[model samples]
Target: MQHLLQIFILYLFILKIFGDNVDENFPQYPETKQLYETYDFIIVGGGSAGCALANRLSEIENWNVLLIEAGGEENKRLMDIPGLALQNQHTYFDWCYMSEPFEEAGLSLINQSICVPRGKVLGGTSVLNHMVYHRGAPADYDRWENVFGNPGWSFDNVETYFKKLEDVAIDSPSLPDYFGKNGPLHVECAEYRSKLYPAYMAAAHEAGIKSELLLGPNQIGVECAWKTTKNGYRFSSNRAYLVPIRRRNLHLKLNSQVTKILFKGNVAIGVEFVCANQTYTIYSKKEVILSAGAINSPQLLMLSGIGPKQHLAELKIPLLKDLPVGQNLMDHVAILGLQFEINESPNVVEDKDMQLKEFLYNQTGPLSSYPAETIVFSHLSNGIPQYEDDFVTSTYEQQNHELYHFSSETWAEAFLPNNQSKGAFYIYPVLFKPKSRGSILLRDNNPFSHPRIFLNYLTHPDDISYLVMGIREILRISEQPSLQAFGTTLYKNKLRACKQYEFNSDDYWICQIRHLSTSLFHQSGTCKMGPKDNLDAVVDAELRVHGIEGLRVIDASIMPEILAGHINGPVIMIAEKGADIIKQFWANRKVG
Candidate 1:
């Protein structure tokens, strides 16, 4: 009895001597926060999905989670304000990466220069985007089942997951589909949209288009602005996911760049990084889930010698896995800043200071978020016909299947979209499913080096036609009487405006696009998801990388195609569901 008492006392003394009574809600990085010294799980890239997974996994209390993030936390004041999302673009929280300049573009973005602002902070890209909460069309995931061999990834399965992460505070009551109460993430609507919104919708209706409530019974029509904002603040994944479950059990590493994934045969053993000036190697007992975005995920895989053999040989890196690592990259490219001198300034941009002040005081302001007040999910006049299996790339064995499909056949398939566009009500469109595909390759073996991202935009002749058709649609909407009411003529007055409105030929539309094209900012499919038969797929339906064990890829990278709407919401749902899948698998294995 005395010995047992002595042992108990000794244990208590040791715990009091070393254990942290640290506040559970406070932030701690993996480099700094080590509760049990080693964790049960290690999640890489603490972005939208990564944080959510980490938070949920840490709920076990005794279980430890080590979350590795290249960026620091930005889910605070500046990032939480919807209006300030753009300001963080050039700040330290942003991984401000630019594309190799293209001569065709009017240097507005870069000489072919595409500036990609990745979140170098806790919430990842969610900290940078306009925070729109679009679940996309139900048919989106249905198509995943139809096109790929992914059986259970339909909307029915994913909707619950979406609800699990979100606690939506919809400002508009007429909006159907209430947000879940017990969810972690907060979603709200945009407070202030440019006055151009109404005219934009009216013009779409006038052009024979219809509106479809995004989360309602269907997704085949025009929509409304529903962003992930609460009141007037941005509701990032970190705010909803990581911050809530931050305790000693969960370690978050920031300002740490993962150098390599140390593997033993097929099992991923651990990861190494350059932190501050020192290098650190952290082992993962359970797994290393990669939540790096479309660009970086593939880049990391390739740097770890998991890409194509030819590409690896070129870079002189030994190939670890020959399966396609950086193939089938797809993104949406749109024309930006189509000018219609506002009849009256929507003033969202002009009154930035007052809006900021009001927000700072009470977190309420018009400019708090984009009043994507009305969203339209319409097919382009030049868009691929809504035939079944249009985006099915699973059976195709070719590397450029998507590119060839988009570049070749679209010329005769599309119409001259109505260009009589309205000037107000904030008009922005998302191409439902683009056929164009791209790839990522390492410039060198160095993990710190930026990889080469070739979007191969408009590589397909059909792609050019659709882009041209999109230009014509923009022209059509701009020509509407509602838009013209504000001296906002939609006729091509691009800096490289068509020489004559009457001579608006295909060449003119093409030239206008080449000059004014903007990235709709959806980069996807770099690390595609599907079965083993999917030649270009990097991970299976379970999101497990093809040739590795105890490793998973969850992020925008695993998307099979560019969804019809913003992919962020869907990506969050994926992470949420993935956490469950992983948890259940581990639980069952433990029982066994």
Candidate 2:
């Protein structure tokens, strides 16, 4: 009984210092005597970008900024623990969306669609995502400038903002120039050392893949994941940026479900929202910024009568501006659930109580490490297709398998599985820069309803061909000498949908991909940013909604194309840049 009591005391001490007690560090939101009638900025969706924008916009002293979130603060046990990353999905903190039935891909999934988990909490999806910190290849940003026709969005211009947001905790003395020294967001390579880490790196090297450091000029390589964790807990956008700066200038409204942006003529004037069964309208004096992320941002635009002409007309919505609000949806889809058996038992961080204790006491254990600890980025496309521009430009039907059957070199991101039990691990292969485009449409005109998300994944033949080649590459990696040294064996999950095909055959693997592939949740590009000439462009280079005044979207939805890696880092960078743009505009206006 004495031993048990001592253990309990130690556990409480650890949690107080590192776990539950960390909540006390945040400054409380100032009490408001009354709700202000207007504000300089009304930022919707207190998510990744919303939090950052709210913090930055409120820095202008008297500039009253209102940040409204549908979900509550990220104060749950599942959110703090790195091992329980996926446990947040489908919970109250998640919007728990489902994509519309895929016409070609995801043939075997439940309801023939994938679960689109958007963060409903204060931190947005930043609190929900696997904390792999990535900024994508330099060429990715160059494409944003050269290919997508957004001039200032080049890698050079955006690189500075990424550095501004990151406070790198990586100890690699040689990698200093590539990372920020004292930024607010804490980023470090996962600390928990595992046998699988070296083995995976060795396997990659043996497979002719070179190890490369990220955030530098070259980003493609197998390395310990750069994560947004510090002291074994998630350093979310809300925690890193909002909580510390909860000043009187910034007003945070929780559970405020925005139904529509209130627009008068062509300008966004205010927002109508519901909270606790009561409805209220909050007006924006200067601008209404939509940082509702990829899913909700476009959904709000459509609901506010800013979308395709015919689609809005069908819903009897009074069209404010006929823009492509929900087209050009792109996400990094992955073929996960690939398990491999090993000679030694995998690291057992799955134990909730033990992992919690370790995180509290030492801040260096399985709980301190990101689940997808190692990642490899490789190109599998044969060559650039002849109708590459046509593929990216064509309508969803015109850009189908008939136009492009993917050849030559394209990008694939490989991740080592997070599970640490049953003497096994899995390899998750994500199809980066997919040619396929999806759409988000209104289920009805109802503002409180969820949007019909149609992530037409693998609709393009190139998407499937690249994934097929990626699976072949994964198989080759599993057979490498380093993995073989650990008695590595592929754990083949027999799919009932693929029972017609023989196991391990190319056709069977293809069947498994269509049946079992899932989304990496890096959803983007619904509100694409392009020049005025571009018809599908919803927002301009400044993130302002086309043909609409005082409205701008500063979230993943404005990404012209998805990045080669995770979207969290890039999204934060976008918010930083967007805030600067808004500030610069306001400053110029004052001077004029």
Candidate 3:
């Protein structure tokens, strides 16, 4: 214990020194003079999509592009450490927005409001996310084309863009050729290499689940997730797509908060922003693309007079076009902190000594891997009456959807007040596609104040029902022979709120889920993209704003429907495809 304390102290000392020299290590942006200058393309919010767009658009030598970010560079040593990913929340790089108190959802939180963390730095959420690189199911995309009226967004059409952005680090020759071979982003299976992983896989198989580790578009089995990491560091969008490329055509403005979109009638002309405590306006001759993520994107739109008319009238803001800017807000809400005790902690060769050596020498170790390594994607209901067509259909619109099971190391320090050294693991049951839809609303017309967020999680009874069923499935998995070999058992932590009901009963689990349910940080679908005539649709199939010209929303906010996977990868793909669409439109204009 004393040795561990010394190591920790040394770690903090190293971090302090490293933090001081951040500006010298990370990429330097050009100094900003004044803002109102005109550029051919002005991409707001230097996030995952914004970074990709800036990189891709700047490829055209003649086109002048400006990328603006609300937060400064993420050069902190903490951002580079993969294990410290969760710690970045509510920190300097995070927007740290909180959701409005829930009426129908979030029954368990302190004030019934959940914390929403968004990236405010150069790479946006990509710099702060869990680094899980999932592309979602193919059927998810087909639904976008067939049901949502987006023709070019089918799995086949968008796969090329997915391939174009990734450089797969995993050497699985036996797997299908869906993965990208030559791309800028570095993706690899985390090097956790725990013995518990194999046992978990075996347990799933014993329970009639033939699981396969997949990195491509399909996610039908149990596997260790592929991550956006190179070596032991977090491979954020800025690192993968922006840093290496030296483009003189692109100008990046850091700490620039866009207040409103400057518009003339229906056409977007420029943006009014605050930088270094000074206000300025910048015009875009071509288009003003919004990639400010799910929360800020919609808030910015509404602030600029492009949202629901009724809401805008209350604030006395002149309405540009009456559109739902913050409606259809969707996220993957999960039941987190489900603990299970094993017979003994698995043999992790060189827990401290080897870890420090490996990280220093080659940047490889358990620290390199994300805390949650294994994930199981399975349909909640098979043919059981409880999981029947009606129950399943009532849960979500997807014909076939899977619940995400995250098996992770459950450090007792996070939960237990007494024994902080207890060995345990966690099983998080995540509702991928929920029936309940929420909204984002303006708190006031103030651009600096955070918009009121309504993440109506588990509003539908079926959402809670699915989660209850997932608990049952987890219990069954624990009972499997493979898991039984480790003497796996649920960690019986006393829940003061759920003590009235019998432990492990349906009612008790339901109570626990409601109180503990929080976001997976996969917030999306506020500015929905669909057919222009659809009243709820904010953007069209081409990602252009409905009833507006020279404007586009090319971020997670524009997702017509949230995919059944982590959003970072798909968000990048949207930017890649959106950039191509912009280039094509320019070429056609020249031809005309």
Candidate 4:
């Protein structure tokens, strides 16, 4: 009877937190009523890049900036809880995009298509994503400059922008030179460490992988993940970049979906959008920046008749400019079925009442951290020293891998059936750089319809081989003495699709890879940025759309190649640099 009562009370608490009336003391951002017919700058998609861009540009005082978002204000009561990060998916806060069916991957999923969750809220994906703060690798930016012909995007040139946006509060061996003491974004190590955390680190050490800070000089090894949080709460891009500067000259319009970019001949003039059953067209005096992420940004450009001539003509939309608007789609693919059973339960309070009380009072409990505790980066090839300076310098075609350590019950409940037993954890081996390329296309002429996304995962044989090798590397780590002492063993359930092959054979792993392939939510490279001579390039080094004036793309879509790690940090950095570039262009124009 006591147990039943406790469970009932806990359920009530859960309802209160997730309810619509939960009190979060933040200022209510009602839609700004003060209207402006024309602004100096208009930024579409108040996402990670858009928020930062609006904050920086509005500092000029004279430049009135407008930021339009397709979603409502962020639900702080639900989003502030870190452990509930994955719970945000499929909710109203998420775009909940469904990928087009592909036979090669996601065979086990419904209709052989995966669900891609992009945030539709004010902060964009930053509000919906697991708050892992990673800066990718320095070599990634070097390639953007040398190989892609983007002049000022080298590691040395962009590192300052990274420092300018960070406020590192973690205690680690990471040097001060690599981090900023005061910046808007607050980054810290996850405060709540499960018992499995130490065991996982020990297992990595026993397997010859050293423990090192990923944000430090080295890129390969195991470490506790740094998150974008503030005082045990999720610090989304909206909170970091927009909240503090709400009083500035920036006007934010929520729930406004942009349908097309309005152009006057070769120059972008404004945008046409719909809000509350009303269609409106607003103008921009200086520039219109598109930061609607990898998927929607390309869709908007193509809808505005700036895509391939044949594709635009098929839909009967007249062409204004001939360019490859939605090519080179890439994302980090991962095998989702890798699981292991361990003897020890996760280091979390089993009592739901105590868990809630601890979180409400002190903010030091399992609810304070994301389910993913640690991340590992490594090369699958042999004969390469792990600690060499060239660890991150390998070409994108090589076999580079990243593994995620997820809590036991969280992994099972999310991916497996309800009948599956608990006390199991997951080690998902992610292919950081995939050679397989995909594309985004318009389903119809209707701007309200969701765009068709095709992430052609594992189409390249090299990509499949890399994932196979990554699985082997993870199995070796499971055999280490540290994990063995905990009585860790692989979950022996055979996927129904792969039951024909021997369980542990290479062929079986490959089958599993195809059936349960998932994305790490790092989709990019759809609108390629490069030199003008490159036929595939859509934007120039300055992020200006080719042959178009007063228009630019300033988001992950402009990445010529996707970076090796999470993209949120890099997107913010890009916006910081982009803000400077825009300021410089106007300042020089005034002088001339």
Tens digits of per-residue lDDT, candidate 1, 262-313, equal: 7889888878778887988888888888888888888888887787999899
The backbone clash count of each candidate, in order, is: 47, 8, 2, 0
Which segments of model 2 are wrong by more than 4 Å?
1-33, 171-175, 348-353, 380-422
Name the better of 3 and 4 by TM-score: 4
| Cα lDDT tens digits for candidate 4, 1-592 | 3323433454467667645443454664556887588888999998999999988999899999999999988766566778666566666767879899998998777677877889898989999887888787888888899999999998899999989999998655547478876888999987787767777888888988888778765678888778998777798898888887665578899999999999999999999989998998889999999999999999999999999899999999889999999999989887776667766566567454576667666666877787678777787222111111111100111111111222333233224332333455677788877889999999988999998999999999988988887888788888998878767787765466788899889999998889878777888988899988999999998999999999999999999987767889999999999999999999999999
Q: Per-candidate TM vs. native?
A: 0.82, 0.88, 0.90, 0.91
Scanning candidate 2 in windows of ten residues, the lowest lDDT window is 386-395
Runs of candidate 4 exceeding 4 Å displacement: 1-23, 28-30, 172-174, 380-422
TM-score of candidate 3 against the unseen true structure: 0.90
Can you list the residue pairs that collide in candidate 3?
A: 36-281, 108-515
376-399: candidate 3 lDDT, tens digit per residue: 776732210121000000011111
Candidate that scores best on TM-score: 4
User: What is the lDDT, from 0 to 100, of the residue 216 in candidate 2?
Assistant: 67
lDDT of 4 at 537: 95
Pairs with backbone N, CA or C atoms under 3 Å apart (clashes), candidate 4: none
lDDT agreement of model 4 with the native = 0.80
- Model 1 RMSD to the real structure? 12.8
What lDDT tens digits, residue by residue, belong to model 2 across residues 1-592?
2333433464466566666444333443443446788988999988889988998998899899899989887763446667556555666788989888866776655557778889998999988888888887777888889998998899899988988998987666676577777877888877786667778888888988788775566655566677888777788998878777658888888888998899888889999999889998999989999999888999899998999999999999989899999999998887754667776765646465776666655666776765576777777222111110000000111111111111111101112233434466667678887888999999999987889998888788888777777777777888999889878887655456667888778898778778666778899999999988899899999999998999999999999988877889899999999999999999999999
- Candidate 3 Cα deviation (angstroms), residue 170: 3.0
